[model samples]
Target: MSQNREMKLAAYLVGTGIHVASWRHPSAKPNTSIDIEALQHLAQTAERGKFDLAFIADSLAINPESHPQILNRFDPVVLITALSAVTRKIGVGATASTTYSEPYILARQFASVDHISGGRAAWNVVTTADATGETALNFSRDKHWEHDHRYERAEEFIDVVQGLWDSWEDDAFTYNKQTGQFFNPDKLHELNFKGKYFSVKGPLNIARSKQGQPVIIQAGASLPGQRLAARTAEVVFVHWDNIKEAKHHYKKLKSQLKDFGRNEDELHILHGISPIIGETEEAAIQKYNDLQNLIDPYEALKFVSGYMGNVDFSKYSLDTPAREIEFPHVNSIQSNFNEMKKIVEKEDLKVGDLYTRFFGAARRDGFIGTPVQIADELEKWFTEKAADGFMIQFPLLPNDLEDFVRLVIPILQERKLFRLDYEGNTLREHLNLKKPKNVFIQKTGASKSYSKI
Candidate 1:
């Protein structure tokens, strides 16, 4: 496979790190979940490596039954907005749910971050789907919308957010002290959007950003989720752990672009990988084992059980042989349930295996050797079209993150598989993605509409 494109990399920093037991790892920094400085350092490390983005993910409510590491999290947007102050080049991605958030407010918040970061902002759009996750929050819904309806709402939700983003043109803000013309009214565009899920008034108060609007990132595996990602997501995150599955998903999503009149290049498909790096193969294996050993199997089971359609796996004997059984329709995340079913059926994994087999962040076969070996695997994935790049979730912070930048990134740079320096300041530019045209301005091709509002 030819490797012409430089692979894009984003730091997926969640919890203390991606691993369930990451915070408790001896090398793990304390209070990373709430520690502003810790998060900032991680972002800076990614920037030092010239990574494309730093993505923070969140679910609406804490799964009280979750492992201790995951129970506490800073709000993603607030955290990224803070990180934007410390890092200059890397994009800040904050996850917000379409199901629970008010579109207008969500739009303003992300737009604010975009301005704060000088256009290095991305919104990782998600629908809240934890069993009792929504109810546990402030919502009073006894029965949450089914998977299809949530996607339906999400589709409309994104449309409204994007529409709200178009409320101003790039040239709208003009402080003409000489003429006393405070602004170009003609350049301000109002988004009079009325949709099933939202009714946003004309024009967001924020001016057009360097990227025109915040980049949209989506992770959807369900049919509807896939469709939504194809239509609107600038970057699509996938849970694919194998090359063959990654290739299949990558091809399927790219295939959907033409239907939306979008170029395949317009959507970057990134597979999530948690890299456990070491100076040597032996060191890397030892580090990975140490991380996994930190996890309490019972706590891990509870964590996956919540996500696996709220099934009480603890009730089943630890050694209960996993079998192919049709799970009932789960409102939480049908796609995850489906994925787990396939894994169990294929591997014949048992309840006992959920700890490392399913819940652990460190994938043994992933970029798990010396820096050069890690780069080799990444290059193969990039060239093979298994991924446009990787959403890299480090196994531990400061140490693990520091090692990747210090070691693996240079190998990728030496091989010309990754960039050593950022050519453009904006996140979209860093990713070689086009800044989106304002929908309202695209239609009129003139600034007259700004004043007409």
Candidate 2:
């Protein structure tokens, strides 16, 4: 811990909390997502602890009948923007789909928030994997692009958005009262980009930021997804069942940076960890077990089944051993498919066992332990290069969140594994990432040619 890099952490504010049944907990508010004050409180708590960022995840489509959490919530970008008006230092970000959104609109949405936040903004680029949800929105249901094509579109979409963000140079604006000129025409570079999926012309309607660009975050594990992260993402949210697996994913993602001419340090890999911190080691394990018991078996089954490519477990007998069966294609999320397949082959888990096993990984990962014990585990991961830091997911809202900040945070700071105080004004500086130069300014090798002082 004493020899480690400063931790870059983000709090994932998912609904009331990360625990599937956190809302039902006595300490949690079931409807906090809809309550602006609750949301603001969560952001404020993280910022108070000097966290690098606070994250809000989103889904464009809904299936309220099954997954109740995401059925209703403010758009991540909009919510973060609102929060930015209140919080001063911590970076804020939200997941926005590149598959379903036009590049221009998406670019504008994040850019506006970044400007308003004084450059503490992040845009988590994602491709919508919910085909049925798209159908509900009147988008081509049957005509949804397959997995590979979606990634391809995401790559292009991200490229176009970055191009638009570079439309104006850092010093392009010159609002001199004596002079009539509003901006340097030569500094306003037009994108004039034409691609297979889009044709966007010229510079964006907004100017650049102090950080030069908003921080880019991507959560992709597929082949194309990995490449996109390597090429552009400053941070990536990764999932792993073990340190060994985390190490492999971390190494593979970092190795790809060379192909894109990117430095390895440019991308920070934060593995998803939902920690259940208790006053004592014994109590922490019980807290985890209590949450598991509180979860409705039916609801847990429904969520994991959808997560596993919409394979129906409704017809299967609870006692029947889960078998390894391969479908020709999976239209849903694919992160844990291979892991589940391995479990079916090696463990021969029952129908009920399958859901419980999947739910544990999906809902809470890393490990359940006391503040001291959890800190030890995280230090192991960080020192071994398994992760740069963790994307924290507290099982319960204010109660659990407070415990982590109050207990775990002090230990990390004491060991020099985390920041003692905020060292920078903007998120980029907080993370120690270099502010990017506008493309036009970087390539031209020209100094600013101001018409008047």
Candidate 3:
């Protein structure tokens, strides 16, 4: 791979696999989701394949009707921290909700992880969107924040978190035995930040790690979400199954960078792909079909409901055309809701059609193929500016994930699209993102003064 550019790959870890029916797969290891050893192995496998990072998605609350993966899972941030200890190179990241967490506490937690992981930590920022209003109950609230309000809070929330991260300068700590001073008071800055959602007063106890701070990861596709990503996220994860849509999204997000005084190179966009690789095309198709057959219709419906902002689809007959059912306003994943609406309008899809077509365990229509064939598609997407790389959501844990590492990755490596081995230690270095300078230092032009000490 050239020093100028290379495909950035991340493993989206879901306990059994990304597939909703993954736990039911014959080859899947039972209880793997809660098994610490199993999770460690998955992270290690991604590292072995030289993947840039391993990410874990999370939600604030779950119920009997919720997806299987969320039913029995560790807190994502904690799991990523444990996974980081087992893997040396692969960046370990997990979703953390800004809505439910205080900026100071969340900032401290990720900063601590960065130090523990040698700066390979990343925080996937989300304003928890629970249409069921269940998550709000968990957080001691009767209702969820309105969509626009959540984003407004998030805008201030991230500003507070990043400000907290810059509390201590890089050279703030001076273990000067000869002198009485412990840290340079002049270098220390407190963030007495007061915003609409958060008021944090701090010089965070933790210092910035090897990579300055944990990488900021975001996956919002709504207008507000896109704006947030444009302003702060170093990595943006997207899920667009087709090239045309992906290209448009890519170009639009990149174009927005200039508005924030950001360059295109400062951020990376990783499209989500749940590939079902097999020995041949027939084998791949069969593999995908087998998983599709295992999906529970009710579970699939619940998944779609969540995406559509908890709108009940059970009242309608399964055979009823999606258009016949009046879709209500949604407060959950806006992009997903809009995309599904487009699908409903474009295709003669019935309620039942969603189970097999749109609401599967994983989206595999574009990626189900043999290794060479999958590689070809990936290359085309990358070359065509559809995405910088992909977030590989393995549909079946260990089984599918190992198949990708053993079969597909080698082909990507051979093509020089991905690195044969990791070239840097920290997540920022792995992604080729520059270490962010301390805000106070940058403002005061004290970098040279600090270096003198």
Of the candidates shown, which would achieve the greatest lDDT relative to the real structure?
3
Residue range with the least summed lDDT across 10 consecutive positions in model 2: 444-453
Residues 290-407 of candidate 2 have per-residue lDDT tens digits of 7777877656666666556566666666776777444335654556566666667787677777655665323344467788888898888998999999898776777777888998
Per-residue lDDT, model 1, residue 112, is 95
The list of candidate 3 runs beyond 4 A from truth reads: 1-3, 359-364, 447-453
Off by over 4 Å in 1: 1-4, 134-137, 324-326, 360-362, 447-453
What are the lDDT figures for the candidates, one per model?
A: 0.81, 0.79, 0.85
Cα lDDT tens digits, model 3, 1-453, are 235789989998888887788899888876887899999999999999999899999988996658888887899889998998888889999899988998888999999989999989999999887668789999899888888888888888888888888888888899898997899888887887766666677879988788998999999999999999999999999987489999999999999999999999888999988888889999999998898899877777887787775767878778888877767887777888889888888889888777566643345576888999999999999988889999988888998889999999999889889888888899999999999988777565764221100
Error of 3 at 52 (Å): 0.8
Query: When superposed on Cα atoms, how far off is each prediction in RMSD?
Result: 2.5, 3.6, 2.9
lDDT of candidate 2 at residue 413, scale 0 to 100: 91
Q: Which candidate would rank higher by lDDT, 1 or 2?
A: 1
Model 2, residue 210: C-alpha shift (Å): 1.5
- Can you rank all candidates by TM-score, best first? 3, 1, 2
Q: Which ten residues in a row have the lowest lDDT in candidate 3?
A: 444-453
Could you tell me which residue pairs clash in candidate 1? 185-451, 186-450, 186-451, 191-203
Q: Cα miss at 295, model 2 (Å)?
A: 1.5
